[model samples]
Target: MNVEPLVPVTEQDIQRYEEDGVVCLRGMFDSDWIERMRAAIERNLANAGTLAIEYAEGKSPGRFLGDMFMWTRDEDFRAFVFDSPAARIAQKIMRSQKVNFFYDHLFVKEPGTLVPTPWHQDQPYWPVQGSQICSVWLALDRVSRESSGMEYVKGSHKWGKWYKPRGFDGKDRYPEAQGETIPDIDQDRAKYGFLNGDMEPGDCLIHQAMTIHGSGGNVTNHTRRRALATRWTGDDATYDTRPGTFQKIREPGLRTGDPMDCEMFPRIAT
Candidate 1:
């Protein structure tokens, strides 16, 4: 279906991202990119990576899934990283002179999946550090709040707090790195303002790594919620291969405080 090709990022988009810490880019990805990623998602599912994890299993009525570093094994994902406008958009939003590829993540929730992604921040789980990191979450299917759409706490990035990282099942990502526990947004939605949008296949959400966000379970009877989040870091983001790293794909041999260079975090845009 020939979606309108992704247009150049507008000034307002950057403003929204900076102010709200999360922005929805309507039709930010072309149909070709969407199709390629959909295919790549299927391939990744068929051959799960070492970091792939399933949140729903035996006796579970639905599928709550996860995977990482797909670009290493999938050509389509590689193309999306190097050929798509993701890096360009990231560079503009981050207001950075250069952009680097961080990694990729895939999350799928089949119909009837009842597991909600716990509210959490992204940076605390990672070995990298900086405010220039961001994620472009692309939807392969139409998504709304009820369909497990990602919900963000507006301006949570400015909170200046590093919350604990927890698994989809609510376990801590690192036992010793436990900082503050994330508030239960679902329990008190009114206390903390949230932003969620209905997104089409070609649409995507760009959010800061420090932004607190997560998705609910898929309640639809037939629709599947499949999403791919390509993370990128800018000039300010640096390597910190400390212990308790989250989703450590290939260790880019850089010492702590070093710039995120090397093949693992290749400079994608300048």
Candidate 2:
């Protein structure tokens, strides 16, 4: 399989990402990568990681499942993390000297799933601190607003604000998390200048760590939404041993304020 991006990350893409805090890159991955990731997803569904959560269990029109750190256990995911073009894309867009592979988060929204993901900033939930942190959300299937495509508040990352992290069930997963609760964007959505739309398989969205984003429920009766978000940290990122945040993998044995280039979060590109 090709390890390079099918479509290169251009200067325009980087400019958009910097301006909007999010950018959609079409055809970033080829069909081969998509098919391999789809197979990996099926494998993950059969054997989920320790961090997997079924938020919509027993109380939904459909199912909502999420898992993280699959690369530590799954070969395909591991290969993708180190050999795929994601790291290169991240480094170019972030304009950093190097890139580190943080972790992979998978989201599966079955048809008719009605559990909306709460609006929040990702950095607050992570044990990291830096503007270079970002996530590459790759679509494994066709995605639309009706199929739970992610929506982001344009340029929210530059708001210099951090929102409290909340679970998909509208509950505080981290009671001790430090941040102001996010505003009710759903009630007054018109003012946010939200960005979201349809995406074909192999398309991906890259967003800054502090970008405020969330997704709606999958109201479709047949189409399922499956996406994998790979987190990456650039030159400025460092370990943050903040209290109240959830760490998916084992401790990296690094002190706070240290560079995140250990074995766990290995530097992938330079």
Candidate 3:
């Protein structure tokens, strides 16, 4: 894996990220990183972490598997983190002078998994603040809307609201979460515009932390939908170590509103 920065980040790409709150980049990651992430995800699935979750088992014909922060436990994940284009992409999307590692996330939909991920913002669930935070999700398999392709509300990050977090298991990830409930964008699809596209291996979707986004399940009977997400924070992102959020684990010595650069969330780009 090679973490080469995207040389000459395009002005148009930056403009789209600023206006739409999300953008999709293609061919930024090569086959090496893609293969490494696939291997790592398979290994993580074999030995799932204590926090790993499986949904739609028995209730449906497929399973939705999710896990996070495997970089601490897997060599391939670590290599990808420190050796992939994620950090560079994050830096460019955020338009920041520096970027820090946040965490790694894995999502899998085997087939016929119909559960839709609830619409919500990512920043409210995390222990962080500031607009310079985002996640880059890479599709390891060919993904379409019917095959659990992630969708984002165009320019939702500029809404300046924090909605309560929702879970994929049809439960509140934060039961006692405070804030406005996300509107039924999917219900009133015409009222709110959406952005989604087919993605292949090495293609990545960069979304603002405050952007409202979610995905449906794999409707196909045989194809698999595999996606890996790497989250990052820019120069201004800081910790908000408050309790009762959707976040499960906490890093040491990071008090409320401290700069988010530590061993757990190391500075990745500058």
Per TM-score, the best of the predicted structures is 2
lDDT of 3 by residue, 143-208 (tens): 998998999999999998888776667665677667787888877998887999999888888999
Ranking by lDDT: 2, 1, 3
Which has the higher TM-score value, candidate number 2 or candidate number 3? 2
Q: Write the per-residue lDDT of candidate 1 for residues 98-133, one digit (tens) a residue.
A: 999999989999999988887888888888988899
State the weakest 10-residue window (summed lDDT) of model 2. 164-173
C-alpha lDDT of residue 70 in model 3: 87
In order, the Cα lDDT scores of the candidates are 0.85, 0.90, 0.83
* Model 3 clash number: 1
TM-score of 2: 0.98
- Each candidate: RMSD: 2.0, 1.0, 1.6
Relative to the unseen true structure, what is the Cα RMSD of model 2?
A: 1.0
After superposing candidate 1, which stretches have Cα over 4 Å from the reference? 1-5
lDDT at 193, model 1: 82
lDDT tens digits, residue span 104-180, model 2: 99999999999888788999999999999999999998999998989999999999988888777765679888998
Report lDDT (Cα) of residue 182, candidate 3: 81
